[model samples]
Target: MKADVQLLITADGSHTAVNQVLNKTYHSIHGAYQESQRVYIELGLFSAFDAFPDGPIHVFEMGFGTGLNALLTAREAERQQRQIFYTTIDAYPMPPEATSQLNYDQFFGTSYLTALHESRWNEPVEVNPYFRLTKIESELQALQIDERFQLIYYDAFAPTAQPELWETEIFQQLADLLLPGGLLTTYCSRSYVQRNMRAAGFTVTKHSGPLHKRDILKAEKVR
Candidate 1:
């Protein structure tokens, strides 16, 4: 319920997590757009979903903060005529008005994108023909979902601010909710996180670092 936690861009243009260390919005110096495109879009989504072109792909997002990624993915799925079951977990729900202020509609088109804003806190609404959004509006620990996901967007505040969410047990449970070959991507390059994912049965990989940092994580939950 606090402010949007804006960042002060450096001369080099990397955005830091002023509010929280790990969950930074974007640093212009680090090429926020580039990092996101590389970690989440290129490596995470494209690589994760490629072999399963005929799939009814399911995405599980941790810390559904700005809703930027959701809008982009939803619009892409719609364009490709793909069926997406997106389940995002967030302890604090952002006001719909704040989400509306973002330029999601400019990229995702207003008609359906507007609905996506109002979709917050609703009763598991199907935003469109291709997108089914289920927002768990409680602590992530309290969520009781048995369905596994094909892709997980591991976006959280950060280890320094909220370490419990990034612990091994939580990621392990996330792996349990995924089928073999399911992918989990995050902007974090923490060794502990990678080790935890391995403990949870993921086949971990070190990917090219984002613009801001030197490395990122892409792990697969293999059966």
Candidate 2:
């Protein structure tokens, strides 16, 4: 596949997602990364990771995007003495070359950059002593994972940009992969998405968002 393209940055220093044609229109590119941090790490996965009294943790991710969130979590696990099993999926995954362009390496520290970029597809790859990543390079609706998760990072693109991937059936399929009380967090705040999550058998809750966004949501699966 051709390399995935990124949008031009705005005067506000935020980038947008543009099509290959260089159109000004597309989804929120920078916001997606920021939102992932606000919802998944700050509100969901990190808290869940802390709640686990034991060491080693398992986290499932809905979108692999630039692997930003995964990298941050990996670094945390590496430093904090807890092992992490992080699984992420994507419909149109960016090449490792594109992933390397992002400066997460600088901010998240160079400790795991080599291991993070070298993680292979189609198998479980360990990036460090504490972090193991399994990447599924397929659309969200087609996930075929058998592992159970304690936390989920739902980082898919906006519902407007990709509606089919955020539907109830897909959420239900994801919910089935989680053990009881596993937490799932996302940047989406649409009522329909919340209702569908409820139908997927999660106890949903709405919460404040990060700097620019209005609100984010998290759903807890209990069964």
Candidate 3:
């Protein structure tokens, strides 16, 4: 179905999906690879490992998108020899052929990209010894899961593009699924979004953003 989605190369020469309907790219125009590394991996996943430094790290990604973040996290898990269970939800999944056209694997020098898309939805599949992925085909607002997460990669479309997913109530609901000290990271630095995270019982902090942006947000479930 997504066979014709325009693929645009970002600053770092990585491809991202351009949703013409929403007029938004799946990742930053500055650099899709760089953005994921900084916002999601460095601040989100790495910090979680630092805080816990033990077995079985759980991650919930709000958007599956290009699956760039998931692939990157999987490589990291293997390298660090840490056990990671990653669950990502996306209501509208891109066609598998579409994801294959993305240049993320070439840019990251990894070969696990195909396995990620092939992994079944709504079921946990072991991508490797250290990384397991559960791809849930559901909208963030409609998602229901009993498992809590130590890290959340909040990679939804911008509020201007998809306002409903960024609402206070939605953030509150997501926060309810987080373990205390869990981190929620996003490329968005909008004041109102941070305010929403705060309203949802997270302590929001501004972090150095990916290229071309001033700041991103990292919200912690403090209670």
User: Cα lDDT of all candidates, in order?
Assistant: 0.71, 0.72, 0.88
Ranking by TM-score: 3, 2, 1
Tens digits of per-residue lDDT, candidate 2, 83-166, equal 889888766666565555655566545556555556677688878788888877786666677789888888766776678868
Task: Quote each prediction's TM-score.
Answer: 0.83, 0.86, 0.96
By lDDT: ranked, best first = 3, 2, 1
User: Candidate 1 on 130-184: residue-level lDDT in tens?
Assistant: 8888777778788897788889988776677788988889987788888788899
> In model 3, where do residues sit more than 4 Å from their true spots?
1-4
Comparing 1 with 3 on TM-score, the higher-scoring candidate is: 3
lDDT tens digits by residue: candidate 3, 35-151: 999999999988999988877899999989889999999999999999999999988888876877888778878888888987778888888899999998877878888999999
| Predicted structure 3, TM vs. truth | 0.96
The CA-based lDDT of model 1 is what?
A: 0.71
So what's the TM-score on candidate 1? 0.83
* lDDT winner, 2 or 3: 3
- Determine which window of 10 residues in candidate 1 has minimal summed lDDT: 12-21
